[model samples]
Target: MDSEKAVPGDGVVVRAIRAGEWGQARRLRLEALRDPVAELAFLESYEAAAAKPDAHWREWTAGAAEGTRDRQQFIAETAGGEWVGSVTVLLERAGTVDPFGGTVACDQGHVVGVFVGPAYRGDGAGVTRALFDAALEWAWAADVERVRLYVHERNTRAEAFYRKAGFVASGVRATGPAGVGGFELEYEMKRSA
Candidate 1:
């Protein structure tokens, strides 16, 4: 399905992940997890993520395609049909708390699992930026006051990208499990005035 098309340096389409696109999602996700820097950004291992049941993949893709009370996922595809990048957004309810140890003071969205294949990195075809623009537009259209994401302390590249896209550090740090020591830094971008 044609969701949204972006004319980055090259033509790329940023669209919602369709129902049957689970297999494609699985493939891209595995490829992302295998990237050398995956350990610094993604929480799941390639082996574990690749082994998830088809039902799980179906559910994940369906929710992102149609959107639910809490989540959505969007994909970036090159004109040649190559899956190049992805981003997922999770809505956090007011007064509730998130899994990363933050209380939801206002209705907001959390962007996660952002990745772009190395080939497309730094091209500024606007593929990745367009994905965030679409996601934030959706969240703000839903009356969300802000959108936030957490980046690993070691992921300076991601941190720089987010900042360039208008996010600022929230000065909040979350510690992961012992094996994954080091804090995750919180960054937020509120709807512009």
Candidate 2:
């Protein structure tokens, strides 16, 4: 599914990231990690991501770009070709273990790495909405029964956006690891299809 926002003149189009565009993906990810809210919004640190080698990015993009069933990343870009935002979805199957060390009891899509540039935030543009719509549509197309995402309790902006997008709290809470600072509350959101 195409990830074009309905509002014209925004010049932002969301689409599946290409494997060869790993450089663009890496740049956007590094920028996301540098956001002021990165500590609460992402699990990885900018230093850690920046330390990774180019080979790592190549492999990362190959696995998450379009055509990969286990994972996919959608990028929001401008007409002039700047990547302004991105979101990735990971397929979790029944009985498998997730990154947070939780058991997946059903076929679902796990949303992660959600971000929009500071200059492009808010509803007036819809860049974030377009990226999310693409991710959810991709998951549903793969017969995923549900789509889930975890947000830090401190990230009210993301939580509010998820709520607006039809993702309800699943009443699940988990303690984050040392990588995410000590003992942060993580809330789970499930798409209400």
Candidate 3:
């Protein structure tokens, strides 16, 4: 349970989703889906997300509530109890076919659903970095060879953030379902020795 904590003095606590916090999770996700750049930054739409039943969110949250190795969701909450951001990391085993129709040649942590509220963005607020730090920490501890994430080709802000976080373009591209509408760019960070 204590495995989740952000660096000090940021006024935000980074932790895994709790079983009963699904409603909050649902709210934050819907909010993220409504962002101006959501079409380019997310694979799902606000309408699609809002249509999901409470049970769906509860089940999804339960899986990530315990910090499991297969998948984990890290969230950032303000000292005042507002959920500002989240990141989900999923283990992609070697020899398996990835969601993008590619073979996963190495054990890797595939990062997804990355989002931070616009109010907490930029260098002035450390929320984004804190959430990613927790996510990367979890991925590395799970023994993944690397952590990778996909950004829509037009999502320049996301790509820039990933680059600043030590991730580099892998020269690989993938196209998601029609919801995504276009190709995605892959960026990754290799695990340290």
Candidate structures ordered by lDDT, highest first = 3, 2, 1
Collision pairs in model 3: none
- Compose the digit string of candidate 3's lDDT tens values, residues 67-118: 4658999899888889999999999999999988789999999999999998
Instruction: Summarize candidate 1's per-residue lDDT along 77-102 as a digit string, tens digits.
Output: 88898999999898998989788666
* Candidate maximizing lDDT: 3
User: Higher-TM-score candidate among 2 and 3?
Assistant: 3
List the candidate 3 regions with Cα displacement exceeding 4 Å.
176-180
What TM-score would each prediction reach against the true structure? 0.93, 0.91, 0.94
Model 1: CA > 4 A from native = 67-69
For residues 77-138, what per-residue lDDT tens digits would candidate 2 score against the true structure?
Answer: 89899999999999999899987788888888989999999988888878888888899899
lDDT of 2: 0.84
Summing lDDT over every window of 10 consecutive residues in candidate 3, give the lowest-scoring window.
1-10
Residue 154, candidate 2: how far off, in angstroms? 0.5
